[model samples]
Target: MAGGVLGVGIGIVAAAAAAAAGVGAERLVRARQTAIDLGVEDDFVDIPDHEAAVISDAVPLHVEIDDPSPGSPTRQPTVVLSHGYTQHHGVWHYQRKALRDAGFRVVLWDHRGHGQSEIGDPASYTIEQLGRDLHEVIGQIVPKGPLILIGHSMGGMAIMALAEQFPEVVSERVVGAGFICTSSGALSTVDFGLGKQIGAAVHRLGPGTVSRLSTRQKLVDTALRAGRDVEDFLVHRYSFGSDVPMAVVRYTADMIFQTPMSVISAFMPTLLAHERTDGLAAFDGIETLVMHGQQDRIVPRKHADDMVARMPHSEYIVVEASGHMLPLEHPEIVNTEVVALAERSCRAVDSGKRRARGVPRNVTDLRAGGRSRRTTKRAAAK
Candidate 1:
């Protein structure tokens, strides 16, 4: 359901998906299928790719600048990309390059314990602490600018924390916000697209299970490393919904696996307790866009709806057949929407007329873009 299960559950299940491959292809497929029936991850486990996908380049990500929201823009508006749990700024690979090409100064930072950032005190792993950390990142790196804050998964929660803790950040200087594959709160209640019984069971028990596993951190890491192929497959399966390049799948795996089981467990409890719907109010008059994958078993689209309901005027998008990692699975759509958000934010600031503070008078309008989806009001509430 959340990273707690994604990290530890994958460890427990990856062994099944890949370890059994030596037994026989049929058995391997069955084990993979069992993981799928649980509905805990993305298109995660249907079977392995026999074709042997290949990638030509192995480019390293260059992450610069860090942290949370707004202030008046002294120059070109800055776009801050916040990634989810078990991920680093690398998660925004496609979007970062696209945004930079689009001419906006983009900033990215790992949440404490993620990517280049050092893991702080275990006690500081809560979303509240992440929010404060984001504030610090903004102060130190971005300095002065009208910010367009974009968050995915836990990163989205951190943005909500920003809204809650520093209202002025959202109202005074933040021109736009983009919430991707994130929930407003009540994470424990949803079944993660698994049936009610299974979903409830996983959410209830997953965190504690992962925490216990973290105590044997080395063993867990060993299991995780042993399941390297499985990790790549699962990352593709759970993180993305559509067909992504095998290289992209492995890249995602690298980013997530680089994170230790300890850090994953450190943040689990807070994620389970995350409830920041009240923070949605901070972006009241600012330009806001909320996106999620319709097929995302993790942090389902309904959660995006919960956010839109609160910020009636915020734009809502759902990429069809997509999973949790929207930016990676459907880069064009995410890039287009992000560019539009930045443009809107800049215009809003320049015009000095913040959009009206209320729900859009019209219900969400779904535009047919063929391969790319333009979700409006959860595709008119689907």
Candidate 2:
């Protein structure tokens, strides 16, 4: 039994090694293609977040805004994009551009410890703190606009935290919201699609094992650069539901690798213990979109369904072949739905009945990747 535990412990670190491998994927691909091809472009306008409160806090979030194209309608509400765990603001690369092009000002920022944002008190890494940070972003950046909040994974949790922490903001200020590839809670119960018993064992052993490995930063860093191929495979398996380019996988992994293992582990407990189902209450009358991949191994489809069940009016989408990285995997679909969501939201969508999955006329059949409802297969949530 002791040996089994130790093996799992070691396995977690070994798996992390690929994720941490630094110069491997970045260099391997940088030589062959431009940085943009590797998905490393940071061309958006960046206005550093320097609010006194932001500066004085445990740490200041790095925030930026993309103004909607000039001459676009001024009535469009500002859209804020929040990324998932380990991902920096770059995760919303495609979405931000899409929103801005669609004539909506877009605000984006890295979470407290991820990306260029300075790492804060590890103790301050709670989801509630993140929610507070988001509130700060809204208070300072888009203080008086009809707002649309879009979150992915942990970012989604932060939004829930925001809703729970500041119900008034959600009820009064937020006109529309998009919850993508995320959960309201019960994250520990997730099995990464490994099934019941085996998943139970992983949940029991994975956190402590990974946390222990996370402490040996230098060792993990060294191991990270050693296994480029392994990292590629592991990231691919965990992130996307369909085959994507190696550049995309490595690019995604590189972003994940940016968060020091220490910070990653620090945030683990909050994620595991997170429960914000109550937060969904704030969106009861607002236009909300809940989307996830049918093939998502991390949060799974059940989580999305559960969220939709709570907010029956929310438009829930379960992309047929996508996975955890729905925004990256199917940018067009995400952008389309989000833009449509914003437009519908601007007009104040009626939070009506729960649209059940299938049942024709409502299903968006885009398995082949087109927006036409006439497409072959669909993934609309009920």
Candidate 3:
């Protein structure tokens, strides 16, 4: 009788603890959502009748958009943008604005485990699965036309995985590819501080366990305290080129913090073991550009150099004063290069020509390549 009473008491305590933890986590998530100031979601002009689809039954993977123009022969080439780990589609804000302004149809979506998207089983958040999502997105969007894939970090690796997994898709639909501040292989071999180690350990533990561990309020609270300082340092070092608006910086930090711990853990393994040099084959006859920051401490500059060496037909540009977030840090430079690539391709397209240009022109070319040697001599003399 005494033992039975003690057992009952323990059960009651456990139940109460579980309920309290649940309430706390719920409150945290809600607070996080409210604190996040991602500016206006309206940056995307919605396309009428656009709908999101649940890709997998086991996972509530979703794809949403404001595809203003659809089924109109896709007049402009489509660029599908993917964000890095612990980040949402908003990371591409600058690139999206620039691309849309340049008359390109941009498609940006959150990965299955991140952002406003529903988080399903932790197992569903692997890099392979992310690549699969890209494949499906491509199938739905550019069924019969060209696509330009732009990815940063994990997003970039996901693109390479897509190329490897769906060779046919690349051969058929993809026209140009951009890898910004990303690695082409074995991220664990690189030195990225806590990112690589924490990522590898999380991947080994499995997503479900990591998710559960992340729910521990004590751990979450402690990490949150330190994570903020780390977040600020990273944002300053990587995200901004120079001085960014304080509001923007704060908003970006909120998005980064609000990202659930499990989501980060699940995708960590994918980044570490990521090797997609083989994916370069898909860019055989396609235009490819690899950009990296020479000062990048995250993805490391050598990874980009290796990619340039591997992808024979690709152009490699090393931005001198940029970090891992080259797309944000050097938006003008990135924008200019992307625009030129698109223009050159459009000219070939309008002329109904399909000759492949193995080498891409650089900033110097844009400034002087078109001019005659005599004009160059005259300018130099002047």
Clashing residue pairs found in predicted model 2: 20-224, 21-224, 21-225, 316-381
lDDT of each: 0.68, 0.71, 0.58
User: 66-125 in candidate 1: lDDT tens per residue?
Assistant: 221234233367888889988877777777656666667777777777776665667777
Residue 261, model 3: lDDT of 62
lDDT of 3 by residue, 1-382 (tens): 0000010111122223334446443443343342243323323333323446546435554554434333323335677888877666776766665666666777777787677667867777677888888887777655656777888877887888887788887777677788887877865554333254443432343334544545664675576576554334345444443343345556555655566666655555555577777667677766777777666655667787677767766666666555666665556778876655655555545665534544532222122332312111111100
TM-scores of the candidates in the order shown: 0.79, 0.81, 0.71
Pairs in clash, predicted candidate 3: none
- Which regions of candidate 2 fall more than 4 Å away from where they truly are? 1-53, 349-382
lDDT of 3 at 41: 38
Top candidate (lDDT):
2
Total residue pair clashes for candidate 3: 0
How far does residue 122 in candidate 1 sit from its true spot (Å)?
0.6
Q: Candidate 2: global Cα-lDDT?
A: 0.71
By TM-score, rank the candidates, best first: 2, 1, 3
Candidate numbers, best lDDT first, in rank order = 2, 1, 3
